[model samples]
Target chain A: MSTSTNVRLAGLHARYQFVETVRVPIAVIGTTLFPTLSLLFFIVPQSFAQDPAAATAATAQLAVFAVMSVSLFNYGVGVAEERALPWDGYTRTLPAGPSPRLVGRLLNGLAFVILGLVPLVLLAWLLTAATLPPSRLALTAAALLAAGFPLFAIGIGIGYSMSTKAALAVAQSLLLPLAFGGGLFLPPETFPGWLNSISMWLPTRAGRDLVVTATTGVDLPGPTVFVLGGWTLLAGSLAVWAYRRDEGRRFR
Target chain B: MEILARTVQATRCYGPVIALDGVSLDVPAGQLLGLLGPNGAGKTTLLQLLPGLRRPTSGTVELFGGYPRDAARRRRLGCTPQETGLPPTLRVHEVVEFVAGHFADPVPTPELLEQFGLTGLERRQSGGLSGGQKRRLTVAVAFVGRPDLVLLDEPTTGLDVEARHALWDAVRRYHQGGGTVVLTSHYLEEVEALAERVVVIDQGRVRADGTLADVRSLVPARRVRLRAPDLPELAGVERSNRDGDRHELWTADSDALVRQLVTMGIPFRDLEVATASLEEAFLALTAPGTQTVALIDGELAR
Candidate 1:
């Protein structure tokens, strides 16, 4: 196939995957609802809700958590469940190679992340003291998307390496701890000295810091960009390794 | 004749178990070949090798003059595994369209659905369809790409009698259009109905390969049924089963056995001589201690 056709096929795959996920909207609803509910119940009634800077930072953290949850459950558990089906096996045998399917899956994950952010962003804007200039809002959205790579890669790694049940358990076990340790639910300033130091190196914290910097123009104390870049590289490599291992074991 | 697929001394092992054991075979173009084997006989393994879904532990598998693993070569091939699960939420037509988009020249969705008797169910979700409908759709999807070679692994395994016949007609139409088909089934009658050439595999090895009649003759038995008064003890009868007043005798040569009865002036009524069915031939050929028997041109060559 020509390069253009390959791209078009990938687009078609993405469309089909999007439609398939939307047809059963429960999973999407749950993933989107959790973070929005957290913002409504936890952040909206607090004193932070009256301060623009504090509320913006908190909203940014929750936004990162939302994307992280979507990536972990959607890609990690979703891909594992797909692998258990015969349709996945049939699709793998097609001559289209893995690019189209992988790209399509990534697009699907991005869609869920965006869908998940809608309600949270609305709550932050209407009820809390969160504020962002339109340009910074766009930039923050872009930065959060970029920051999603490592989370997406981790999800893929877990998905390809484990069964659906195992992936779900592992993803859940990792998500909350990463969020808590990364100061997503609690501000890093209040964390114990050791946790505050350790959170700087965590991908979740790096992502939250990057989003906060983008949205509120905050200066991060740590090398946030470098930390995010390094985690992306590590998680990306792990994802590729897991995919190859799965292909070897199942297809060969 | 063009050779679409060939396996040369190919053996596939799943850890300690051998699924295909050094089996060499050829699938010529424009022929419908049936691969008959009992359960755990490696029929699925053999089909999987042809589509490059699984690689042989040793030797090679070639398709369309290239390696089966080649993507370009695979473009000309289509296959349905023993079990297929369609995307549950998508309508039947949508599934067909999605699969069709992958090929350069695909049959239109409406026409393909009609061919498989799925026209009325086009709007229905695949998950909501009956098992027989799902099976029909699965088989139909294989032909949507208009592939040069189609591999169907037990295509009508769970279909009712009428549905099985419908599928047979569709397969026949495809074959008549000069498409090459390699289908696997444990049903002896299915092979007998659809195949001009039969390859019988058992215990991960090809036990017999020949035309349908050639494989049937390998059994060395004929069924002779008759009703007679005061039947005599016959030396030529290998075994006899009595149902009602009729005696069914298994013999090497029914003609000779009948001649002996006539020469003895025995009065027999309602005499019938029937050749062994493919089921009997399959059993006799795949029986223990038979080893690998390859019949070339109606003669046992190996």
Candidate 2:
């Protein structure tokens, strides 16, 4: 097939997969509601809402949390479950090759990540004094999406390497630690010295720092970009290795 | 005839278990070949190799004069694995259209569905279909691309009699249009009904391969029964057993055995001669050891 045809097929795959995921109401609700409910129950009731800087930063942290959750769950758990299906195996044998499906899955992940942010963004805007200039907000959104790459890679790695049940457990176990350690729930200003030093190296922390800086004009540490880039490179490599290993194990 | 696909001394192993052992076969274009085998006969393994779903442990498998794994070579091929689950949420037509999008030229969705008796089920989710309905749809999806060759692994497994015939007719239509097909089935009747040529596999080896009558003729041993008080030694009698006054004998030449009985003047009455059915032939060919298989091969060689 020509390049244009392949691209069109990839788009079709993405649209169908997205439709499949959304038809199951629980999947959509589970992905979007968890983070939005967190904001409603925790941040809106707190006295810190009166402070614009703290509230804005808090909202930014939660927004990053939403994106991370969607990326991890949608790719890690989603891919693992799909891999177990015979239909998936059949699709892998098609002449169109894996690139179209891979492209489609990535696009689907991005769509869910954005979907997960909608509720959180609406609640944050309505309930708190948290605010950002439209241009800054757009920059922050771009930064958040960019920062999601490493997490998406990690999710793909988990999805490809483990069985569905194991992937679910791993994704769940990784979520809270990464969130807390990255100062998503509580800003890095409050962590003890050792924890703060360790947080600087984590992908989540790197992503959170970069997005927060983009949103609030906070000065980012010198190593944030490098840390994010390194994780993306490492995780991307792991994902590829896992995918090939899976193909070898199942098909060869 | 041109060969569309072939495996030269292909061997496949799942860890220590040899699923297919030193097996070689050629699939010619536009032939509807039935793969008849008991469970664990490596039938599924052979089908998987053709579509590049699994590579042989050793030896070469070629499709369209290229490696089976090559995407370009698979363009003309369609396949349905033994069992598959469709996405629960997608309507039947949606699934067909999604697969059709991959091909340059595809059968129209409505036409394909109608051919498979899935016309009214177009808007229904696959998860809502009955077992037979789901099976029909699974098979129907393979033809959506209008592929030149289709590998169907037990395509009508869970269907009722009516549904199975529907699927068979659909397959026949494809074959009549010059499409090549290789299907595996536990139903001898199915093979007898649809296949022009049959290949019987057992214990990871090809036990028999020929036209329907040729395979049935592999075990030419006939069963002869008679009532007699005394019997003379007979030529061409493979084995003999006595049950009271009634003697039973197995021989390759029932006519010669009968002649010997009459000439010997053994006071025999109520004599009966019966040829083996295809089922019996299959069992004889696939029997536990290499004895029957070796005999058949020797006969074929002669």
Candidate 3:
């Protein structure tokens, strides 16, 4: 848990320590979202323009999907590929072992968290007819980051547990369901009773709740933030375990 | 340091196949140990235990007086593993710098380049170099931190006679600097040049450990090839070959055996004594446990 040993960090010495991982994958997530979200907002708007409220909600739904695409899908693939590189092999052999190594990765993850959120914020601003309160925008970003942290951990775990192909599949399959149940796409009040009740504990629900509260001055109870933080912590631990497991088994 | 880089005891079984059967040996620091086993003889597996790259299913491996955890310990060790790997796009200076960054007092780049004959190639990328040049570059990195101990498993994998001789000089310089070198190679000459002491490991067990002359003393000295008009059958000899009137006798000591043959009035055409080489002596030491008796007869059977 505390990787404070003085093992040297070898092979991959990055110039920008905080943003190394973000440097590559953020471009991947950002570019992928640009075209997809752009098409949804510019092209599909004609279909739902008659109902402005529906259009607004649909645009909001698209932004949530973009978050899912990058955080869970692209981030998982990036982390897995990094592990498989021989550069990582050289890094481990260094005298100052895993201590400096994990620090680099953790710092990089937080940077990506910021990189991943920026585009979604800009898209949210562009898609809304009447700007949601600035306070709402700020809350939405914070909530997305809080919610995404655990999913990033879970994504990293999946990346290690499965082959590259399998990790990608798991990421994509879980994205829609996670977003839908979290109350990002449609209000949880409109969901079936049992589904709405269960959604309260899910990361997506807490994330959407935080965002809604920030935007509309509608706060979900403070307990919701704790549940979301708990998810992130649990997933973070699992990711570390998954990484060690996969590396130990791969001898060649 | 008198510390064991790795020690394996009774380690065995690779899935259902047995790799090391009660194989126990200590790798003392500060000397080159030759892992002298034929293909599938488990030499690679034995070295893998040192860096904590592979775990023995039943034994222990210690590096610098502690259990090996990962490559970090190996980073402190210089192992020219069977595979001398480097990225294609990496320039020679980059490779040196990369490993240098991991250490506190890395060997000076210009000094190492000049010593290893890599001065001009410092600007060149590793992938574009010849096989021998690549091996040289890899060795340069191995000694980057002037590691606690250097383990060279098949060190000169790609060099010719000239380059190998150059490498031997570099190895000697490393030792002269008070650093220890552990070298292993199929080229007995390289082993002869690098290893101050030798340990022959066959089938994951140490068959012999001592100086080259000391181990050579364990096996026979000279092999006698002869042609005689009247050949009295030699008794107690392991093998005798006959072609037409020529009789070639393979024996442990050529001087004593040849004197006896001459005294017997065995008038022959020709007789010559061939001095025992390291390969010859190694075969004899590892011969008994060998499932194939090929090394026993030397080239006679083949």
Candidate 4:
């Protein structure tokens, strides 16, 4: 097939997948609402809402949580559930190959991630002291996209390697710990010295720091980029390996 | 005849258990071939090989004169695995269209669904369809791309009588259009009704492969039922069962058995002689310890 035909087909597949996912309202509602609710109940009622710097940093941290939660559940639990379906196996046998489906799924997840950010952005702008210049706002958008890569990879890795039941448990269990340890739930400055040192290396911490610096004009530390890059490489490798293992286990 | 797919000495082993052992077969274009086998007789394994879903352990499988694993080569091939699921949330038409998008020239979505008896169900969610409807849809999806060859494994497994006939008509129409089909079924009547050629597989090997008549003749054991009391031993009778005063005898030579009964002055009435159905022929061919043989030119040989 020609390259253009392949691209068009991928676009079609992505649209259908997006429609299928959103038709189940709970999936969209849960992913988009949780982070926005956190910002409303916790950050909006606190003293941080009056401090421009603290409010912006807090919103960026919550944005990291929003992006990570959606990426984890959508790729991790979603993929594992699909692997058990007969339709998924049938599509693999088609001559068009796996690219269309993979690309479509990734694009669908991207749409939801963007949808999730909307409410949080609006709430922060209205009720809190979270303010960003046009340039800084653009930078934060780019930074959030960059941080999503490792989380997406980790979701895919867990999804392909585990059964549907196990993936649900793993994704759910991993979510809170990663969020808390990476200082997404509370400020990293409050951590004990050793905990503070350990939190900086977590992918969530790396993602949080990157987004916070982008939104608040803080200087990004030297290790932040390396930490996110390292996690991306490691998680990407795991995703690929898990996918291959799944294929071999089923079709071999 | 042009061969669309072929496997040469293809064998597949799942760990220590052998699912197929050194099986070789060729699929000719424009022919409807039926694979008949008991459960666990490797029928599914053989179909899986043709579609490149699984690789043979020690042999080669080819589709459209190329490696079966090549994605481009499968463009002309369509297959419905034994079990499949349709995305629950998508409408029936949407599911069909999504698959049709992958092909260079696909049959229109409306026409394909109508052919499969799913016309009015365009808006129905696949998950909400009845079992029979789901089965028909699965089979219909195979014809969407107008493939030259279609592989169906137990295509009518869960359909009611009416639904089965509908599917049969669809398959017949496809075959009449010069499409090649290779289907496996436990239903002897289904094979008899559809296949131009039959292959009986058992214990991971082919015990018979030929025209229906050729296979029936391989085990020419006719069933002879008669109401006879106190009948003497007959020379040509292979096996005999008695229920009250009725006796059912199976023999290769019913003519000789009847002559012996008459000549011995045995009083027999209500005699019934029935030819073997494909089910009996299938059972005789696949019976355990029966040496494997191929029928060539209406003659059986090892």
Q: Tens digit of lDDT per residue, candidate 1, span B228-277?
A: 86678886887777876788888898989999889999888899998889
Candidate 2 stretches greater than 4 Å from native:
B81-84, B221-275, B291-299
Please list, in the order the candidates appear, how each scores on TM-score for chain B only. 0.88, 0.84, 0.84, 0.90
- Cα deviation of A27, candidate 4, in Å: 2.3
lDDT on C-alpha atoms for all candidate structures: 0.87, 0.85, 0.64, 0.87
DockQ of 1: 0.57
TM-score of each: 0.93, 0.91, 0.73, 0.94
Query: Model 1, range A51-113, lDDT digits (tens) per residue?
Result: 999999999999999989988999999999989888887875565767888888988888888
> Which of the predicted structures, 1 or 2, would earn the higher DockQ when compared with the native?
2
Query: Candidate 2, A160: how far from true, in Å?
Result: 0.9
Q: What would the per-residue lDDT of candidate 3 be over residues A64-114, giving only the tens digit for each residue?
A: 455555556555765666555555554455565555665555445555544
C-alpha root-mean-square deviation, each candidate: 3.0, 3.2, 6.3, 2.3
Question: How do the residues B1-302 of candidate 2 rate in per-residue lDDT, one tens digit apiece?
Answer: 88899998999999899999878888899999999888999998998998888999999898988898877888888877334568888888988888888788999999999899998988998888888888888898789888888988888888999999989999999999999999888888888889887888888888887877778776666989999987877899877779899997878899999988888888988999997556767877787774434323225741
Runs in model 1 lying further than 4 Å from the true structure:
B81-84, B225-255, B259-273, B296-299
Give the worst 10-residue stretch by lDDT in candidate 2 chain B.
Answer: B290-299
- In terms of lDDT, the poorest run of 10 residues in model 3 chain B is B293-302
Q: Against the true structure, candidate 2 has what lDDT?
A: 0.85
Higher-ranked by TM-score: 1 or 4: 4
DockQ of each: 0.57, 0.65, 0.23, 0.61
Tens-digit lDDT track of model 4 for B1-302: 88999999999999999999999999999999999999999998999889888889989999999987777888888877333578889888888888787788999988898889899999998878888888888888888889999999899988889889889999999999999999998788888889988888888888888888887776556888999787787898777779988998888888888889889989999999887688987877777877756664366778
lDDT of residue A103 for candidate 1: 88
